[model samples]
Target: MPKSKITETLLNSTVSKYRNLLKFCYFLMVFVVISCGNDTKSKVSADTNENATTETETEAPATTSSKTILFYGDSITAGYGLDDTNDAFPGIIQFKIDSLDLNYEVVNSGLSGETSAGGKSRIDWILNQDIDIFVLELGANDGLRGLPITETKANLQAIIDAVKAKSPSTKIVLAGMQLPPNMGQAYTTQFKAVFSDLASENKIAFIPFILKDVGGVKELNQSDGIHPTVEGHRIVANTVWEVLGPVLNSEL
Candidate 1:
């Protein structure tokens, strides 16, 4: 063989081998890039699915199906001086409902310094929702303000009538309140009797003396001797629950 021909053959063979090596390197690089892209997409998809599942698990349960119990009243019913609203009677009532797995939602519509007249005006707006049990605890402010008994009674009757008119099937629970002897026997007696009269006349459920043993007790009441302490509210919860529990069971 000629030397030139042999050298040319060797050179060509070397060039072809180097070109093949470069092509193989390019193929390897493309494979790595494609694999990394697919891996990144898989990780993102898995993360998205995991996040969705976590959100669903932590979401709050819906309350649309629950029956609502509306607690309508003044500061005492509002849990005036309590640390948290949950520490109040209405909240305690809710805790009981949750514990018993009752299908009831307690709405604390108590306003501080609210009078029966105030409640009368707000009754339409408050009764706007679906109320299963309407717990009326008003007129305490009216009595405290030395408001006329007849006016207070009329206001309370109007509120009750409004609740009845809005939700006719709603069970009415009237919470009777009393004033101190400072308010005088005649007026206080009439104030106390007003609730009884309304309950009797309307044939509704009644909770006489909603405050019961909690009123005037130094420890049970706040320093103002008006609002109840946490412990006091606990007793009040029991007082209300006594009548409310039965109404709930029978109504259901």
Candidate 2:
């Protein structure tokens, strides 16, 4: 072959070899870059976990039980239509507190069909004496009977403010109740919010929705589908005691 032809062929072979070498180097660089990215991501995750651990460690300590609580309100609170000892949440709560050997008395002040207006009327008579804590479980009947949320809220506010005024040291807990779904969404939403709003304003503990687990279940409620059965009451007791047992300091 001629010298020029031979040189051209040699140049073509060298260019092909150089292209292959360039591709191999590029792939190695890409692999190293991916490895570095994974390491950086792992470090960030570790740092986030470390910060979370430190935040939890710096959180405040929990407070122990402080005082006795009196259960006050309407029919459900009063144990309406339930047998003397059977299916009564108040009775069940009393048993548990005694069993736990806690220094809190479960005082039953439930009045059947009692409205917020009625509670206001008898607040002076029913509780002329002092109390360490008050569990307000009203507004169920108000919502059930389709009473105005405004009136219910006002009555509840009055009762809480009265207790605060008379017994400034008392810790109050507001037990929430949900109005029936049939009562339109607007009304139900407002009614449900009343307890939380007041509790927030007063800096009190709230049960959110007391009848949550008790309501709707066929076995839990009685024939009326309104009152909870004895077993249901036990569950209710557990619910209230969950909140009540922690704050009580001594027997009432």
Candidate 3:
């Protein structure tokens, strides 16, 4: 072979090998860059997921503890004639409290035909549970029965004393009552004064007359002419709420 032709062939082979080497290096760099990008994305996605999980694990639910309002009364508080006792004033008040998002539980500890003397006897048992607010609604039956005014007053006072002794912090709300004219002018007058006098003496909250607008109104009362109808109870709830609302709000 001629020397010039052999030299040209060798140079051509070397050039081809150098070009192939350059191409191989470019492909390896491109593969490494793509792999590194994919690994970075995976790490970022993993970090985001871990942060989300940590936040969810650390988060807590909100909770609230409910206080109690106890209505210690007679047939009026018991919703005697109503099909559902929820229509009673105490339950209506509970609905109002819930609507306002106030955390309070209303307990109606009323008994049908409960009188001042009866209330005095059973007060200790009712006081067994904690009472944030205590509403006393008695003496109406006593007045209706034409019982001795002095005895009724004494019984109610005893109940009040028992409550104070049991829980000094418990707020007492004295619900006043009045007797119909048939009970006698002097007797009725004395009965009406009983609640007011006790309230003043004890320095407690007082409802002048729990029945207020509902008492003498014929439409308000049920067939018994004594126990309030559902509508009547609603009105009574409003009257009670006027006084009770402030006390509850103060606690809040």
Candidate 4:
């Protein structure tokens, strides 16, 4: 064989090997770029998933359901002697709830001068209700009649228990009352403590004194002094609304 022909063959072989190595290197560089791109895309996808979950969690709190409340009380709650339906606390509360767009209603279960025994007797009628919240407002009549404090406490406690047993999910708010000074401090204290104790023992909610800062005010009281006037009802509604508003999550 000619030397020149042999040298030419060798050079051709080396060139072919070098070309193949160059192509392999080019393929590796492209593979690395594709791998880095995929890694970046995966990280972006994971970040997007985390952001979506966080957004859903943040929105959950705004979608909670609002609660309903029932107004259960006596003449004072009944808007006794107020000649108009809107003059009652139920009416007032209804208006407030409406303004705030709360899913609630105020069931006015008021009776005039009803004693605790009467309340006990009529309890089933009251208990047989689909109430989410109960404003336990009784015992004023019992206090007026000089009824036994123990009796009043028992009746109120029974009502509270019944509400819990029946509804189980219903929240109780004891609208507390205080006796007139003429009743004497000892009896007054006992009468007042009836509600306080019942509410405390049951681990339920309470309104320190429903008529606080408004009960005996002449302008706020009705002609009877015991009952509230139209203006008085407004005050009472606001008083009851103050505690009840937060419990029911009702606006205004």
Task: Give the alpha-carbon lDDT of every model.
Answer: 0.93, 0.83, 0.92, 0.82
Weakest 10 consecutive residues, lDDT, candidate 3? 57-66
Residue 240, candidate 2: how far off, in angstroms?
1.0
Error at 90, model 1, angstroms: 0.5
**Candidate 3 accuracy as TM-score:** 0.76
**Residue-wise C-alpha lDDT for candidate 3, range 128-173, written one tens digit per residue:** 9999899999989898888888999899999999999999999999
User: What RMSD value applies to candidate 1?
Assistant: 5.3
- In model 3, which residue pairs have backbone atoms overlapping below 3 Å? none
Candidates' TM-scores? Answer: 0.75, 0.70, 0.76, 0.70
- How much is 25 displaced in model 4, in angstroms? 88
| True-vs-predicted CA distance for residue 252, candidate 2, Å | 12
Predicted candidate 1 versus true structure: per-residue lDDT over 130-246, tens digit per residue: 999999999998998999999999999999888888878999999999899999999989989999999999999999999999999999988998889999999999999999999
Per-residue alpha-carbon lDDT of candidate 4 for residues 145-251, written as tens digits (9 for 90 to 100): 78888888888877877788888887888888898889888999988888778888998778888887788898888788888787777788888878887877533
Error of 3 at 5 (Å): 67
